[model samples]
Structures are given as C-alpha cells and as structure tokens.
Target: MDDSNENVLTGSASQSLLIKPDISTPLIDSKRIDLQTLINKFHNQLGDKNWLKYQSIFSSFILGKLSRNEFENEITKIINSNLLINFHNQFILSNLANSVRINPSPNSHISGFGFNNNNLFNMNNSNKKKKNLNNYKFNNQYEVLKTNIMSLPVKERRRIKNIKRDSGKSNLLSANSSLYITNPQNNKSSSQPREVITGNAVTWSQDIMTGFQTLLASESYELPDKDTLNYRMTGIMREHGLFGSLDENSINVMSMAIESHLKTIIEETIDLVRYRKSKYDEN
Candidate 1:
C-alpha cells in the first residue's frame, strides 16, 4: 500500500490532474455514429471476446431500437442472470465505457451502454395502430329492420266485445231476455222500445252453427251450472263430430237433462191446449 502511494505521489501532477473523457455524453457533431454501425461494432467486438450472456442488448438498444428505459432494463436483466461472468470482455475494457453509468446519481446503474448516442436507428413501431383494451370487438351480430307484427299501426287492432253472460237460463228465455229469438227478415217485436229488425241473420238454411254464432253475436251465454257448460261444450263437440273421443259419462248426463226438459215442455203444451178447449166448450 505504501509503495503504491509513493509511486502515485511521484507521478507528474499535470498527468494526474488530466480530466477523463465523458463516455455518457455523445458527440453531437457531424461525426455522430449510426445505430446500425454501433450495433455492428458491438457484434464484431463480441466475435473476438468471450460471449457475455447479456450482450444481445446491442440488438435491443441499437438494431431492435428500443427507448432508453427499455435498454437499461434489458441490461439489468443480463447482469442479474445466472452466469459465472456477467459482462462481456469488451465491456470491461477501460476505454470502452470507462466509469459512465446510466442514471444521474449513485442510486442509478451502469447496465446501459452507460452513454448516450445522438444518432440512433431506433425501430419505431409507435406509428402502427396499437392494440389496447379499446381495440377489442364483440363477436355478436346485430339486426337492422324488425320483421315482427308489433311494427304495425296500433289503431289497426279493433276490439271485439265478448258476449256478456248470466247464470239464469229462465231469465234468458223471457221476452225481455237478451237470448229471445228474432226473425231478422220479419217485422217482429223484440219486447223492448221496439226497433226494426236488421237483415243480418237472414240466411238460406237454418244451420246449427249459424244459430250458435248468431246467439254468440247477439248476447252472452251465461252458464247455469258446470252441467250446462258440458251441455254447450258437448253440443259443439257433437256438431264437430268430436264428442265420442272424450269422456262419455258427463256427455250422457247432459243429454239426459236436455231430453227431460224437452219432454216436460211438450207435455205442458198438450195440457194447456186441452184446458183452453174445455173452457171454450163451457162458454
């Protein structure tokens, strides 16, 4: 240690005081280095020296043309890699980069070229449209015009009032009953503030379906009992020839009721005629 100090003291003061060249600051003059040329130099230098695992940084910093931060990060990765020797031999040469570092202060590093190159051939992919979160698209397709009925005018739907119904069958048979018969073609009193009959129901044949349709049009048919419902339903089913395909017991019951009512009406009509004739004879 004493011998080293004595030799340094004996050295010329001017030589010792000579300022070192700054490798971190590049020359801004016309002799500026090309990025490709710099990378080529690094590649050639590596040919004569031991391969440093991280020396590919030349491609990233020069040929690959990355920004400064990217260059330092890559260099840091090589330095921290699992290798016996981290840096290339040419990198350690005293004249190569000297004591230059990447960052400005002591807390910084030397992973970079440790210097700036004014002329860099950085590959710019920035101009290309970058695929970010916004670049994504949904895979679904959309329809333009709706072909549904809902697009029609609302007023086109005319409301048909349902026939009103009552449970009393006797009430339906009265003169004032909404179910009372009418000859639309004849001058017949409907037992109300009488009005002239319209010719709507005048048809060639007395069709059962025509009667039912007319009845439904004139007034609501009220059901007196569930049996009455079976009566009307079975009647419709019979007219349509579908009655035998369904439950027979209920159909038979309604048929019996209808037959009994018809018989009673016929017998009462006969008794009324005999009584009226006997009264005429007594007079």
Candidate 2:
C-alpha cells in the first residue's frame, strides 16, 4: 500500500475505536455499607468521646477536602460505625464533611462521583425526623397540664379555692377568688341582694377561677402532671411575691406575678406538649 493510503487506513481504525458504546458501565459500583462498621471506624480514627463536636466534619467533606475515593472510604467507615444511624442526616453529613478532606459537591453521593438521588432524599428525611423529635420533646408536658385543667368544673374549682384560703394565713389574695362587700348606704332595700358591689362576689370569684383554669388548660409543659404545674406556679408566684401583704404594692405585685406565672406556665407547657408527642411517636 502507498504510504498516504496506509496513514488514511490507520486514521480510520483509530476513529472507529474512539466511538463510545451506546451503553456505558459505571466506574464505581454503588453498595450499601454496614452502619456499625462505619461508626466503629469513625471512632477509631477520630475518637468517640465527643461525637457532637465533630459534627462539622460532614459538611467539610461535602465542601471538598478529600478525594472522592477517600471521602467514600471515610463515609463507609462512618456508616458502618452504627453511630451514624443514631444521628439525623444533617448531623451525619456535617460530621463526615468535617472529618475528611474532599471537594464534595453538595449533591455528591458518598460512593463517588456517580450521582445517587436516594441518598439525598434520605438525608433530607433524616433532618426532618430530628426536627420533629426535638419539637415533640418540648410539647409533651404542656398538653397534659392543659387537658387536666380543662376537665375541672367551675364549682369544684371554687371548692379548691376555699380549701386554699382556709389553709393559708397569708393576707395575699388567691387569683382564683376575691371578696367585695358593698356598704348599705349605697342603696337601702334595693333588692339587689346585700353586700353586692354592682356584681356578685361569687360571680367575680368564678370569673377569676375561670380565667386561671383557662390559662392552665391552654398552657403547655414538658411535664403536665399536677405536681409539675403546682411546682411551676409556686415558683413563679414566689419569685414575684404574689402571696404577700395586700396593698397597692401587693396589687401591682400580684398583677406582675400573674403575668410572670402565666408566661412560665405557657413556656413549660409547650415543652411538655413536645414530650407527649415524642412519647406517642416512640409507642
């Protein structure tokens, strides 16, 4: 063959060889690693005493401090460690990134440069679970208190108020009830009933009791039992001297006391409600 013809034939063969196949095989096969092994390896390399502190490592890895191979190895180590199972996706991802040196794309699979959509979805779901867990812990107690308080009748609440009044010698007024007596000079035989201050004392007492009951019923807590509610109320009242001398100062104090008391109860109740939700989830 002529030299030019030989060169042309060789070029044609090289071009044919360069053409890619319609179906391409993956460079790295994706596989699920054992979670326990991953965790153990992670602890061995980074020390397990303070796992929370190293949570940022996962983020660092995604940002790219390690090669794809090295990152996969470390991630596999973490997954097999069993520790990652306990953590939510955000925690796992952040810690893993921090521990490794790799320029991981925000969307890169732990397996390598190859993309896996499932892992991303799993990570998002894990984060949601963690957030829900935290919220549940906070609201558990509050719901209990609210339910219990709401179940009490207005009359029964009055009886409880009388009991509290008889038990204590303090001049401080119970938020549950108040007494108001009218002078006879205001109206003689008005038939409005004697000692009435435009409104009946019983009615006023009921109103106050109802307000407190409503507050209790609506409030949330980490622990919703009676003991917790009582303790929390007492603490708040005492802090503001709600059960002290009855005067203008005392009135102002009581108002402030109720405000503070209600605030604490509300906050605690929210925590309790969260707890209840968490417990329900566990069950």
Candidate 3:
C-alpha cells in the first residue's frame, strides 16, 4: 500500500506537469511590439499597396504571439507575393526605396500633403521666373549692343577726321615758327622763305590725313549680327571686368552686372514711351 501511494503521487505530479495551464501569459510590451507604428512607417515609406498586405501579416505576428522566425517568414512571404505588377506600383516602389535610403523630412504643415516641400516648390518656380526675365533682358540688351557696335566704324571715322585736322593745324604752326633759325647755313639766309616751309608743312599734313582716311576705310572690324549678339555680349561683358572673380557659369553674377543695367534702361524707356503714347491719345 505504501509503494502504491508513492507511485500514485509520482503519477499525479507527472500528469499535472503534462497538462497545459489555461491562464494567459503576459503580453510583450506595447512599445516593444510596435506593429502599428511599423505599419504606419511602412505605409509612409512604401505607399499603400506594398504596406497593406505586409501590415496585415505584421499585425498577425504581433497579436498571435508568433515567434520571430515566423514573423520574418511572413515578411518574406509578403515580399515574394506578386502584387505590384502595374507600372504605377513599380514607380511607387522605386520612389519608396529611394525614400527609405534618403528619408526626406515631413512637410505636412504648409501643403497639407504627406511628404512634399511646398516652400521648395515655390522657390523653384520663383527662380525659374527670374531666369526667364534675365534671359529676356539679355536678349534685348544684346540687340541694342549690336546696333551700337555696328555703328562704331562710321562714328569713329568722323572722330578720326576731326582729330587729324586739329593735329595738322598744330604741326603747321610749329613748322612755320621753326623754319627761320638764328644760324646762317650754306648760302641760305637765316630767315628761310615762308614758301619752302609752308610747302613742306602741307606735304606732311597731307600724308597724315591720307593715312588716317585709309584706316577709317578699312573693314577689318566685323561687328556682330543679331544671331550672334548674345555670344558677343558675353565676350564684351567679360572684357569689361564685370564678373571679376566668379566662375563663367555663374549666371547670377552675369545677370547682376548686365541684366540690372539693361532692365533699368528698358523700363525707363518703356515708361517714357507709354507716357508719350498716353499724351498723344489724350490729344
């Protein structure tokens, strides 16, 4: 009877150990699980489609007390699923991958959109308008500059003629005064005749005038046409020391120097023209 009771006690203890308890195990911390947060993050990063199925699987893993290995297997299953077959889905996936690698800061305040920087968009648009304005100003200034440069040769000829005439008169005065010297030499009187000096003076003046005229007549300088005006303006601006230290690609530097001047002049002229037109209309 003692052996039998000992055996029964051992058997009861073994049976008790074999039977599963009905009591619930304490769940993992809500913070540690974080399945909802992970789902939201995945949705934000990967869009709705890819995150949809994955979110369900993640939820099941968290709620069902699935092992880590099982959770990872579910993730693999979702990844291997053939859900994203459309071009739009592919584009979204590509953008999602890029976002995951370089997560942009959320800009939910301004545009009320999830991930767009409306400020940056506005800035880009403003910059584009500025660029177009600069280009328009450049084109107008280039046209005016071509007209001015092309007129230079004719204008320079008149200037050179005036300068030569003035110089010739000064030379004639000097030659006439110097012709009569204090010393007598070789049968010629110290007081030389006015005719001889006057003749030599006329000859020298004629030679200089002829040379100046020839230079004015030369067509070596070819001014830029309308098609090539912008290219020529770039060269002229560089030569004028406007953009001293900046790189050649610095459009802002070029525009600051060239466009500002042009815009001011053009606006003033336009205002004047409009004023004149309004007065004429009133008349």
Candidate 4:
C-alpha cells in the first residue's frame, strides 16, 4: 500500500510540472522582416553595392539555412563595413563634442547696461498720462477761477475746475522754464523756487535708443531695405536726433559701426548653417 501511494504522488507531481508553461520563452513565431526581398528591390537602385550580399545572408538565416551564431558573426562583419565603422566613429566623436561646450547657453540672455540687468530694462511709468489733474499744481490765478467755478453744479464744477487748473499749470510751468523769477521784496536768487520737472518731458536720446532696441527685437528685424537704410543714415545728419549735431569724424565712426554690425550678422549666419550641416553629415 505504501509503495503504491508513493508512486501515485510521484506521478501527479510529474504531471503538474509538465502542465506548467514557461513565461520567459520568446515568441519565435513573431512576424519577421523580409530583408532579402527588400534589398533585392533596392539592389539596382542602391549606389552602395556592399549591402546586396547582406540581404541574401539574412534571408538564408531566416530560412534556417544558417545557424544563429554564424549569422550573427557574418552579419556583424557586413554591417560594420569600412563605411559603417567610419560613420559610427564619427557619431561617437559628435556625441563627445555635444557633451562638451566652451560656453553653456551663452546667448540665453542679454548682457548690457539698461538691457541685461536680470531682464530687459524699461523706463518707469513716468511717461504715462494721469487719469486726473489731482496732482497738477495750479498758479495763483487759478484760485480766482476756482471761486467762479463754485457757482456751477458739483459734477460740472469739478470738471471745469480741473480743465482750468491744468491749463494754468501748463502755462506757469512753461513760463518758469525760461525765467528764474525771485520774490520782489528779497530780489535774491537764493529765495527763488527751483523749477520742477514735469513728467511729460523725456530725453530724446533715451527715447530713440529704447525705440531702436524695440525695432531690433521686433518681428520686422530683417536686413533693412535701401529706402529704410537711407532714412536711418540720413538721421545722422539731423540737428536734433540721437546721431544729430555730431562731427564728420563721429559720423565716419558710426558708419563703421553699421558696417561691422551687418558683417557680424552675415558671418554668424554662415557659421550657423555650417555647424548644422556638419552635424547632419555626421548623423
């Protein structure tokens, strides 16, 4: 009885082991690429004749005419032909080059005064017009007008008052710009009030420079047309613009600057195309 029971147990265990399927086994019946047919289709068209034999060998291996080890060795020899080895070496050298850089993202930001300080610099909102005349300083004459304004309704009174106040303020400031008027009783310059700058005023040179920067950064920043170039060049001869009131020597220096700028742009563009072409060739 004991011997028979042990035999039954052994038989059942053997059956279970046989029933279990291997999960690690590869799907060898998966669809394979027809390298031979593909190569033959291109054989006549292909300038490189070296690839023709590889297709036959690959097909033979696929058809069970060659062992896996023999196929691997032979195919490796074919794929790593002189041309392929040179291409692979070139790829490796390029990867090494891309990994190394003399300067990392050097042009990611601007780097100059009033332009490169953390971000592109801009003037404060001093030039923006105020919504009201509350901050405007009126002259003594506006006081008499304000008294006459009191007779009007509240909303109308306020509107008329502001208009008159602003108008008087503008006239007074313009008059004060030319004259350093002092108190008649004292007749001393020390007693005179210093002229206050109005927010509407801006330096023309600074404004021009800011505009130039915007123009350069704009979408229209292609090489200037002849008319546009002529217009810009003529500005140098102006008596009031950024390049205005300059001597002949200064104008010549500025012309050199324009030439240098255009030359640099063209050369850098050439270098960019060359670099891209070299990278593509390596690939």
Candidate 5:
C-alpha cells in the first residue's frame, strides 16, 4: 500500500509537470513586417527606380545595421538633396536680404561754424549758407516768435498754435524759406543707397529643387507648371500685388528665377540617378 501510494504521488507530480497552463506563449510575430507590405509602402513614397536604388540603404537602416542618427541624417540628405535652402518669400520679395547702406565718403568736404564763449559766432568762410549772414539780425516778428517758442515746454513747442498766429500771412513755402538755416556742407551732395544681395542665387535654385524633391517623394508626384510658379511667385509678392501688376523688370527676374530653379532640379535629378546606379552596381 505504501509503495502504491508513493507511485501514485510520483505519477501525479509527473503529469502536472508535463501539462502547461491554458495561457498561450507570446510571440514576436506582431513586431515583424511582411516583406511585400514593406516593399509596397516604400514603393508608394518613392517611384520604382528610386525604390530600387534606395532599397539597400533603407533595409540596412531598418534591420539595425545602421545607427539611428546616421539613418536619420541619410534620410534628411536624401529628402533635402544636400541643399541648404533657408529663405523666405517675404524676405526675398521685400528685398530685405538685399539691404541698402549709405556710407559717407572720407574725402567729402564738411564745413561748420563754431560759437565762442562770448556768444560770438566764428562762421567758416567756406560755409555757403552762412557766408552773407555776418550782419544779419532777426526781424522783430521772428524774434518775438523765437522768444515765445523758447519759453514753452519742449514738447509743447511743436504745437500748431505756437506758429499759426505768429506766422502771419506768409504761406508755408515762404515761411519755410525765411528760416535762416545753415548747414555744415558748403555744397549739396547726394549718395545713392547701395543694395547688396547677401546670399547666392544658387540658394533659390536649391530651395526650389528641395521642394520639387519633396513633391516627388509624396504620393501626388506632380511637378510645378509655369502658371503654378507664377501664382506662387505672385503670392510671395502679395505686398506688391499680383503677377500682372509686377513691372517688366520684376516679371523678368521672377521668370529667370523659376527657369533657373527648374533647370537645377533637372540637373540634380540626373546626377542623383547616376549616383544611385553606381552605388547599386557596386553593392
């Protein structure tokens, strides 16, 4: 009886060990992507030739053979095509990137009068505006006007009432002409404001190419046409008005810009194709 009992106990223990719980074992199947599915997904984003050319690179990245940062950088380069195009339509259209600067010439002549401590003026002989004013004295009306103006608080001096009544029948032009204004310069001089474009034209071409590349990478896979380009370029110059309102020079510039960008995209696409072919062949 004891032996039989021991045998029964051992058998039950063995049976328990052999039988597993009702719960199923978890699997990694959910994590795995089907090959066909992956191929189709990539094919949609990139065209057939591009998919083939970039397959190995993408595969390596997905399979953990490539580091995450390296993969992201490679993807960025592919998308941007290594084009550093960071510019705004507003900046370009407003010509803000091409800022103007007025630089005084070192050789330009400047003359002025200096007042002494005794309240006497030592006018520079070459100063044309003050040349004949040595014997000049302010008229009574103007003197009174100046005195009253000087008595007012600084801000209140600009009030129209201060000059409206005092500035008798003289028209605005005549009143302005009567003021004895002197200038440091003996002669009137002018300098043209110089506008300098800060960036290279290649930036525009690159920017357009990057956008074109992005479009190709999308599902639509459409290229921009002349009308589309015109519309978009007009939008950039919205502050100025529509494309029709643009002057001949502006229109020509925009046309050239669009043509150059399109040309750049084509050239870049050809080069990319060639590069892919070589890389694929080597692999």
Candidate 6:
C-alpha cells in the first residue's frame, strides 16, 4: 500500500503523469493477523456507537474465554433489551451469530439471533464435517500442509532483474530526442550485478521435517499413506528454487534426509496407535 519508494518512468513530451511499476506487491502487511488486531481494525472502521455495548462479550467469545452457550445467553439479553430495528444492526447481529457457528451440520439452521431458518452457515459448512479433536489422523494435516506449500505462488525474480537492466539502458539513448526516460532507482552507481544465492536444502530439510514431526506428535490423526506422501514429497523436492537450486548430489542428500525422517514418523505413529489401544483396554 505504501507507494512512496517506487521507481518512476517517463517519456519525452508525454511526461505528464507518473507510471506505476509492474512489480508484485503484497496485499496485506503480514501473512498472519491475530484476533485482537482484527478487532482493533474493525473498531476503527465501524466506530463504537453500537460496538461498545457488545465489545467485551464478543471479544471474550472470539478469544475463547467465553463458551458458546454463555455467549448466546449474554447476547440474547442485549437483543431483547435493545432491539435491532435497522439493517446495519441486524447485519451485525447475524455476523456475531455466524462467528460462533463453527461446525453447523447440513440440516442445522441459524437461530437465537433473529435469523429465520437461515441455512447459509449450514450450506457453507455442509461439505466440511466437524473433525473430532481427539481423533488421531495425521494424513489430512499433512495433505493440507503439502497443498499449501505446493500452491505457494512463485515470485518472478528474473522479471525484476530484467526491469532493472532495461531501465539502465535508457541512459544510452540520445538526449536530444523528443522523448526521454530515466530510472533513478537503477542509476549507474547502484547498478551492481546481483548474485543468485541458493539456499541450503540440507539444513532447510532438517528444520522442515522437524516442524512436521512436532505437528503430527501434538495432534491425534491417522497416518498418511507412504506412497502418496512420497509422491508429494518428490514433487516438492523437484520444485525449482523452493529450497533454492541444489546440484544432483545435494538433491539426493536432501531427499534421503527427508525420507529417512518420514519413515521414522510412520513407525512412531504405529507405535502410538498400539499404545493408545493398550491404555484403553486397561481402562
């Protein structure tokens, strides 16, 4: 959103307006936004006239300090005493109801917030059945993480290099021409050749596998299929510049390391299932 440091390009007689750069820009400041941060943003945007009344209760519910039943009871009292007459108030009430309806079944309807047989939430969640917290299923989590990593958009670093190179060439053009252009950001003093530094896949693989192990250990889940996991892992390894460019030898090294760790995880998960069953028999 900050455009103050962008480079500008101009043509001779047509140098009337500033042209925006073609470089990719991030939509948000960071990848993650916490609940409190979101609440502050909403408060600033929507103001506090009606917000002040329910901010405390809403914050508690959102932060998991208040249970669903308690939140519904508190909100109902507010709705009864202060009727939501306008569309804005009704919309706010509906949103509040929606925030707590995390796992509505297909036939479930939105109630207790003036919504008349609303199946919107139900329809949205119909495809996604509620997952039991204690069910030991590691396959789904692994697949989700794999999908996220694979779907990550690759930034065209080459395009930036080309743009900087072309911008430098403008200085060689005839100054007497009717049109002229220059790039202050790509001036001769700062026009140094950038080195393509590849990241260490061996070290990165260690950390990546460790993190995945931690995730699986903490969660109860079924073990993922080895062949499917191997297939996805192979694709990830073959992915160019993911962990940076690795030579044939280095590629084999990293692949072996990750595969070895994955094998250990599969063994541990089987042991865990056996342990859980033994404990249940004793109980």
Model 4, span 28-100: residue lDDT tens: 2212222222223333232233433443454454344667667655655544434443332333222222222
Q: Model 2 has how many clashing residue pairs?
A: 65
Candidate ordering by lDDT (highest first): 2, 3, 6, 4, 5, 1
Candidate 5 per-residue lDDT over residues 14-124, each given as its tens digit: 122221221122111112111232233334445543433343343454334566566545544333321111111121211211111122224322111111111123345
**Candidate 1 TM-score, true structure as reference:** 0.17
Clashing pairs in 3: none
How far is 277's C-alpha from truth in model 2 (Å)? Answer: 86
lDDT of 2 by residue, 1-283 (tens): 3422322211112122232221122122123232333444444444432332233333334334445455444444434332333333323333222222223335433332112222211334366765764464336435764677678998976766577434452121122221221223343546555334423323332222222232232334232344334433443443222432224454456556767888999999999999999999999
Q: Model 4 misses residue 215 by how many Å?
A: 13
Give candidate 3 regions above 4 Å deviation: 1-41, 77-283
Task: Per model, state how many residue pairs clash.
Answer: 0, 65, 0, 0, 0, 10
Native-vs-model 2 lDDT? Answer: 0.37
Model 1 per-residue lDDT at 263: 90
What are the Cα lDDT values of the candidates? Answer: 0.33, 0.37, 0.36, 0.35, 0.34, 0.35
Q: Which 10 successive residues of model 5 have the least lDDT summed? A: 110-119
> Top TM-score: which candidate number?
4
TM-score of each: 0.17, 0.16, 0.15, 0.21, 0.19, 0.18
lDDT (C-alpha) at residue 194 in model 1: 25
Off by over 4 Å in 2: 1-27, 44-49, 64-283
| Per-residue lDDT of model 3, residues 153-270, tens digit only | 9877577557743333210112112211211332365577755554433333222222222211013243323323333343333322232233445544544665577689999999
The residue ranges of model 6 lying beyond 4 angstroms of the native Cα positions read 1-245
lDDT pick, better of 2 and 3: 2
Q: Give me candidate 3's TM-score against the actual structure.
A: 0.15
